[model samples]
Target: MIPALFDRRLIARRRRRAVAAAVPGSDFLVEHVAADLADRLAAVTRRFGTAAAIGGPTDALARTVTASGRAERVIRADVFAAGPAGDHPVDVVIDDERLPFADGSLDLAVSGLALQWVDDLPGALVQIRRALRPDGLFVATFVGGDSLTELRAALLAAESERKGGASPRVAPFVDVRDLGGLMQRAGFALPVTDVDRVTLRYATPFHLMRDLQAMGASNPLRERARGLTPPSLLARAAEIYAETAADPDGRVRASLTLVSLSGWVPHESQQKPLKPGSARTRLADALGAVEHKGE
Candidate 1:
C-alpha cells in the first residue's frame, strides 16, 4: 500500500512484496507501526464523522468500526488484491500522498504504519489537509527515530567489520518535533505531535527480522540494492545485535517508537467573535480602560 518515494515506484512496490517475507527484525518494525496506530486511532475516533485511512487497511480496525454500526468505512485498497472482502465498501480512492477528494472533503484522515516509506512528506501532508473539511481532524502515526537502536548499531558494526564501509542502513525516519510544523504549514490549525516508545522482547534477533518481513516493512533502499546479503555478513550482524542488546532472560529487546501527530482543518465555525470589546464592553468601561491606559 506504499506510494512513490519521490516517484520511486519500483522501491515502493518492494514494500508490498514483503507478504511472504520471514525476516523477524523487519516484521517487528512493520507490525510495530500498524499496532501502534491501531491503538491510537481507536481511542480518538469520536472526534470525526467518517474516518478515512489512506494507506493499507487494518483488518481489526475496519471490523471494529463497522460492527459498532456508527462509523463508515472508506478503504482504499489495491484493485488487484483478490477483490474487496471487508465489512463495508471501500469508499474513497487515495494514493500514498494524494487523495481524489477536493479541499476540505472529509471529516477525518488517518494512516498507520505508512508515511515513512514516502519521500515527499510535506507534499503528502498538503494533500491530506486538502481532503479535510474545515475543522476536520487529521491523525497519523508512523515509525520514527530510536525505532531500532540495537539493530542499527549492530548492523553498522557488522558491516564495517566485514565490508569496511557501512552505508547508513536504518533508513532515515521523521521526528515528532518536525512533523507538527509540517501540519501547520500545510494550512492545518492547532497541530500537535507526540511520540510513544513500545518495547518488545524477542527470543532471537532473527525472529525480529522475520516479523518485520511479515508486516511488509522491509527495507526498500534504492542505492543499497545488491544481489546477495552474504550469509556470513547476516550471521555477524545477528551476533552483534544479540550481544549488544541482550536482556537478562537472554531475549533481545527492540524499541518501536511511534510518532503521533494531529491537526485540524481550519474552520469558519469558530465560536470566538471578531471583536470582543464591541459586544462585551460598555461605554463607561471603555472610557475607564482608556483612562487607565493613559495613566
Candidate 2:
C-alpha cells in the first residue's frame, strides 16, 4: 500500500482516538481486532521471511515477527509514512489498500483488520491478486457477521419500545459465506474463507462504545443519522442494552467476527477454450448405418 495512505490513516486514527478517547465505545473492539490482525500478519512475515512489513504504530502485528526471535533479514515500511515506494528496506509495506508495488511482484501479502474499512473490497482484492506472481498467496482478515450484535439488538429494541420503530442504523458487517465467493470471482485460486467470533462482555454499553471509537471505527458511512440523538433516547437505549443484553452472569456480550480469507494466483489453470473444430467424423455416415440396420 502507498505510504501516503498509511501516514494519513495513522494520523486520522490518532485524531479519532483523541476525539473519542473520553467516550469509551465500540472503538475498543476495533482496536482489539486491529491488534489481532497485525499479529496475524506478523506471523506470516516471520514464517515466509517476506521482504517487508507494514502497519500502524502499535503494530504488534509486525512486532509479532520480531517478537518471535526468528531474526530474519527483513525490512519494514509504514506505507503511510513511506516517502517513496520500495525506498524502505522492508519488503512488505502495510498501509491501507492502495498498494505501491507493481503487478505480480510480491512474494507474499497480508493485511489485518483494515480491509473492512475499504469501500471497494472486490477491487482491492483483485488488485492484491494482481500484485502476486503465479501461485503467490495473499491472506487477510476483516470484520464481518454478527459483530456488535448486542449493541445493535439493544438499540433496536429500545427504539421499538420507545418510538415504535428503529433509530439511526448502527454498523453493519459482511457475512462470511458471501466473502468466500468474492475471492473466486476475483480470479483467485483455491480461495478459502472462514469466520471467528470473539465475544467479550462489557460492564456497560458506554464502555463498549468507548472502545469502538478508540479504534477509529466511527460511522464513516455516508448514510449515517443526520440529527443528534436525544438524551432520553440514548438513556433508554443504554437501559435496554443493560437490561436485555446481559449474559447469564449479567455482563453484556459483544462479538467481533473476524473473517479470514486466503487465495492463490492461478499458476497453471486452463484459461482458453479447446482448439476449435478438431473432430472430423461425419454425422451423415452414422445416420445411414443406423437406418440400414433398422431396415
TM-scores for all predictions: 0.76, 0.67
lDDT of 2 by residue, 55-115 (tens): 3333434455455444343345443332233222334544445666678666566666666
Candidate 2 weakest lDDT stretch, 10 residues: 81-90
* Per-residue lDDT of candidate 1, residues 90-208 (tens digit): 45533565557676667877676677767779888988888787877776778887798888888889999988888665667877678777887898887778878888788998877
- Go through the candidates in order and give each one's C-alpha lDDT: 0.66, 0.61
Error of 2 at 55 (Å): 5.4
TM-score of 2: 0.67
Candidate 1 positional error at 178, Å: 1.1
Model 1 — TM-score against the truth? 0.76
Off by over 4 Å in 1: 1-15, 18-50, 64-70, 77-80, 83-94, 270-295
